[model samples]
Target chain A: MRADARDNRARIMTAADDVFGRSPSASTDDVARLAGVGIATVFRHFPTKTELLEAVLTLRLERLRERARELSGDAEPGKAFFEFFTQVVSESASKLAIAEALTAAGAVAGAEAQEAGRGMRSAFNDLLTAAQRAGAVRTDAEFPEVYALLIGASRGATAAKLDPAVRDRMLTLIYAGLKPYA
Target chain B: MRADARDNRARIMTAADDVFGRSPSASTDDVARLAGVGIATVFRHFPTKTELLEAVLTLRLERLRERARELSGDAEPGKAFFEFFTQVVSESASKLAIAEALTAAGAVAGAEAQEAGRGMRSAFNDLLTAAQRAGAVRTDAEFPEVYALLIGASRGATAAKLDPAVRDRMLTLIYAGLKPYA
Candidate 1:
């Protein structure tokens, strides 16, 4: 695409993300307005709302995948794993909302996004394995269990609608739980 | 009330609880069928589905409050708190489903259920305070934080679709996180 067209596309995606986050039932016109673009421009870029959602989800997953890859090579495995866990929990909460909206809007994740998710999980598992080997995490810990804890901590934060200090406490508690058994 | 009438009410409530648990969208007819009573009889007792849900939630919360009070007087504070935590997490998962369903069905809790819930939370906080005083739980932990952890861990377990062993592991992991610094 041309440079101006590329800029418009990026703007549309970013605006759509914000609109969806603020209101799951956002309309294309709302997204276009937020993007400072006309409805015609949005349609020119993406033919359908499902196509737009699919594009947004794909972008989010790919970003996660990229971050995981960058963190994969860090020398301090324990710090790397915990940092990644925190990042995933905080970020995934909103990303998950978008994913759910996509599904509700009848826009299933295509193969590319599914592959991105798999890649992200595998990198996360690698970090966990390294952390466990360093005796930072409990020996009995499994990657699936770790992922569950991440989701749990995030869920806890949402359920409690915790204030900042309390949210920090919850996250700290999650980190403490992952420490090697006493 | 007559003995038979009391028996029928008990039966209807029990069956309603089960029906709502397995299927949040279950109809009153479904509940009556489960209770082995006529639809007319169910309506005679509850007047409406909201009334039935209020009754069920009230009963569940009262049972939790009773258990909490019993545990409060136990000599072993650590055991009491941890056991109560386990009981709440495991049992409340199903109860939460009913609660959510009730909300989705537009049934807000009546004052009675709200009072019962307050009673339960207060008892739980007392248990936590005792445990912390015993040096079994961390000092910084708050009641809301603890509740959030319980909900989070429960959610993680469900979202992971964990097997019993992994589910057990998730609970153990949450406990590990709750301990005072090693």
Candidate 2:
């Protein structure tokens, strides 16, 4: 692809992310308008609205995976893992809404998005393992369990409509629970 | 009230619980048939199916509150609180289903049921306080935080369709997080 074409694709993805984040049912034309590109160009890039949504979801997961990769290199493994965990839970609300919107729009997660999800999980597991090896987290903490905790915390906080302070407190308690017992 | 009338009402409630548990969409006539009572009798006890659902939900919460009360009287505060927490999470799947069914059936949780829910919360708080005082739980934990944890844990487990053993392991990890760091 030409450099200009790659830029156009990236712009379309960013615009779709914004439009769908606000309204899951937004049309591809809306994304095109937001991207300041022709509808023909948007179609040229995505081919279909579902494909555009799929690309956006995949990009979101990939961004997280990239962030996790950076955090995994931090010297303080415990701090790195906990901060990544907190950040993920906090960001999950909008991401979940987007995913649900994609589902509601009849877009089955494509192979690319699913693969990105696996990449995100693997990156997270690396952080968790680092924390445990550093004696920051409980050795018994499994990836699945922590993953459920992340889902639950985000979902519960959203359902409860908790204020930031209260949600932070809850996260702190959960972090405490995940740590090795003295 | 006549003794037989009371017995018939009790029987009707039990039948409603069973029928709704199996099929949230089941008709009240089905409940009457299961109770071996006339439709008129069921109507006499609960003027509306919503009323019947309200009564059952209230009864379920009341039972948990009563159980909490009994556990509060136990000599072991930490054990009592942890056990009650686990039991509540385990049972939440069915109760939540019933609640969702009630909502789908156009039943607003009646004032009585809401009151029972508060009563249950208060009872659970007593156990939390007892556990904290006994040095089993961290003193800094607040009621709202713990409540959110309960909601998250139950909802997450259900969403994951986790097996019982896996759910228990997750619960144990949550319990560990709630405990004070030595």
Candidate 3:
């Protein structure tokens, strides 16, 4: 893609995320205006609100994957794994329904959503695997279980409107539970 | 009150709980039939199905209170507190929507539901307070926080369809996290 087109796509994605964050009912026109782009351009890129949301979810998956890649190379496996977990949990707090939303977005985004999900699983598994190898995490603690726990915790935090200190406290407690029993 | 009338009410309540447990949408006729009571009897005791459900929820709240009372008498404060948490989480796995259901049940049940909720809180707090004083729980931990955590964990367990071992695993992890950060 050309530089201007790439820039337009990035701006639209960022704007869409921001707009949608504030309200799931945000209109496409609102997204276009926030992106400083024409309505036609927004339509040309996403075609529909569901598609736009799909793209946003896809982008988030990619960002997490990138962060996991960076964390995977860290010297401190345990710390890096938990930092990544915390980041994912924090990002996922309000977006806990993203998976269901992506599913409901219809057929066009199905393959893409699964691809993003697979990418996310792969990314987190990399961090978890490394942590286990370093003997920092419980040997039997599977990525799937951790993923399930994080989903629960994120939604819990959102429902509770946790203060930052409380959020940190809860996360730390959960992380400790994830550690191998001493 | 006559013995037969009391028996009918108990039978109706037990049947209603069983019926509602399997399907929240279970009909009053079904409950009446299961209880071997006439439809008029059912209507006489509780004018609406919502009222019956409210009655069932009230019973659940009372049961929790009774359990908490029993646990409070145990010699081991930490063990009793955790035992209560585990039991509540277990019973609550599929009933996470009980509070919302009660709220939507309408005006008559509202005060009673709140009273039951308060009763549960007081009971659980007694165990929590005892545990904290014994230095078995973290000083900073509060009953409200624990309540929120259990709600999240219970829903997560339901979503995950966790087997007994895995359920125990996750619960242990969360419980460990609940322990004072050593």
Number of the top candidate by TM-score?
A: 1
The candidate that achieves the highest lDDT relative to the unseen native structure? 2
- Candidate 3 per-residue lDDT over residues A155-181, each given as its tens digit: 556555566667677776688788887
After TM-score superposition, the amount by which residue A31's alpha carbon in candidate 1 deviates from its true location, in angstroms, is 3.2
Predicted complexes: DockQ each: 0.54, 0.42, 0.34
Question: What are the lDDT scores of the predictions, listed in order?
Answer: 0.74, 0.79, 0.75
> For model 2, how does the per-residue alpha-carbon lDDT over B86-164 read when each residue is reduced to its tens digit?
8877775544543342222223477788787778889999999999999889999999888778777776665555667
DockQ, prediction 1: 0.54
lDDT score of model 3? 0.75
Candidate 3 regions exceeding 4 Å error are A1-12, A22-50, A94-109, B1-59, B95-111, B180-182
- Would you list the rank order by DockQ, best first? 1, 2, 3
Candidate number with the higher lDDT (1 or 2): 2
**Per-residue lDDT for A68 in model 3?**
88
What's the residue-level lDDT of B78 in candidate 1? 81
Worst 10 residues of 3 chain A by lDDT: A97-106
